[model samples]
Target: MSIYSPLPPEMIWEGWEDFKPVWQEIKVNGRILQVEMQGFNQARVVRLLSTDPADYLNSAYQPGCILSFSPQQSTTPGAINDNPPV
Candidate 1:
């Protein structure tokens, strides 16, 4: 019986509450992407393995906003590929 003391008196206390992610990681254009938060809106893409394909850039990113990537290493879900460079 202590979930913030059942605040229900014209509630008014905004502080502490900045941590929610079913999956996050974004740095678009520079490399590093792994979004997966489809609850408050949308944020697909949970795969992207670049060995040197120009780092695979061109992902402005949309839906809400609040990225901070730092984890990359994927490739095995359909195996996207389109080789065409010497």
Candidate 2:
């Protein structure tokens, strides 16, 4: 039996069940994503790395909003600055 066949309704996103991350470069077409690298509030804190303040100008983004990033670097956990940027 297929997973989608047995699933009840309301478990899909506009008919698609699974999601693939939308990967995007930090800067494209004069646009950048304001991402939240840490914390719940004031999230999108990762924007510190982006020099452009207009990246998120008049944009609505909340904490826990997923962001797509690349370079796929891994950082060690623990005390702030303990590891290189991820």
Candidate 3:
């Protein structure tokens, strides 16, 4: 099996073409990609990739925030490059 089997706990949320939801909340509690999003006002989502969750809580969030993952990105599955050059 692959090193990182299975995927993280996906969070279902929608953004305005850009992923600028509530806030990115991630933790390295387990060696798995886990993302959780809350609904304050409007839809929000989180996509986990690396073993470490991408936390954005209390961080900068606003318009023009490019979403690295989305329908446009669905074409290329497993296309995220979080690893270093070998």
Candidate 4:
């Protein structure tokens, strides 16, 4: 990758290695969505994982959309549930 910017490398790549993103897979409306954790019960949609082309047309699942979901307890003891957004 070649960067032709007049700015020095220090200004362009400052804190580049220090940044880490938290990614999680969440299911919403029967579609699985890859999202980046924004905060408690909040996430930013990164991409949609679906076989149906119609699933990609939904604006709710578009990248960069914010989704809010609640965590639920699993029926199995000591298990976590995969709860979709309400």
Candidate 5:
């Protein structure tokens, strides 16, 4: 019997798209915040990757803001990164 099972949490972002809702990293007032958005929907402000959630909440949200995502070598099945990279 093989003992190499991995369970990862499911990440859900409202209004998800194949490649449109791209992940982004923004610099707000010298702090960095990771975000992902789809259409005109409210952008998802990633918390775990940021220094503080409060900073993101207080910072002005501009959908036109441009950012980049870090590359992940491997991603868990059914996770957000499961889909082909954007």
Candidate 6:
């Protein structure tokens, strides 16, 4: 895939190698969301793992939107226990 940003690649991909995003799956309004952890209790929406078209229409789950969530320990391997803040 080609990125057509006016900025130079160096500027656009600065720290790309060191940029390791913490990805987590979260459930919100009965929809599963893949998010990148931005900081404590904060995560940025990456994508919605849902088959419903209505889920894509919800502004709250849009990519780049920041969401607040409470962290929880997961007992099952590869399972997400954190829930978005009410």
lDDT string for model 3 (23-83, tens) is 5443233322233343333223344444323443312232233323322333344555655
Which pairs of residues clash in candidate 5, taking residues 3 or more apart in a chain or in different chains? none
RMSD of each: 12.3, 12.7, 17.1, 5.5, 15.8, 6.8
Clashes of 2: 1
Badly placed stretches (over 4 Å) of model 1 are 1-18, 24-32, 39-41, 44-53, 60-86
lDDT of 5 by residue, 60-79 (tens): 44334533345444445655
Query: How many clashing pairs does model 5 include?
Result: 0
List the lowest-lDDT window of 10 residues for candidate 6.
77-86
What's each prediction's TM-score? Answer: 0.24, 0.20, 0.20, 0.72, 0.28, 0.62
Candidate 2 accuracy as lDDT: 0.42
**TM-score of candidate 3 to 2 decimals:** 0.20
Measured with C-alpha atoms, the lDDT of residue 33 in candidate 4 is 93
Per-residue lDDT tens digits for candidate 2, residues 2-83, read 3565656565335474554343224324555445344332224233234556544533433345544344333545434565
What lDDT would each prediction earn against the true structure?
0.53, 0.42, 0.36, 0.87, 0.50, 0.86
Q: Please give the ranking of all candidate structures by lDDT, highest first, separated by commas.
A: 4, 6, 1, 5, 2, 3
Residue lDDT tens for model 6, 1-86: 89999899999989989987778888877899999988889989999999989889999999999998787766675554356435
Report the CA-based lDDT of candidate 1 relative to the real structure. 0.53
lDDT of 4 by residue, 12-73 (tens): 99999999877888778789999998888889999999999999889999999998889765
Candidate 4: 10-residue stretch with minimal lDDT: 77-86
Q: Residue 12 lDDT in model 2?
A: 39
TM-score of 1: 0.24
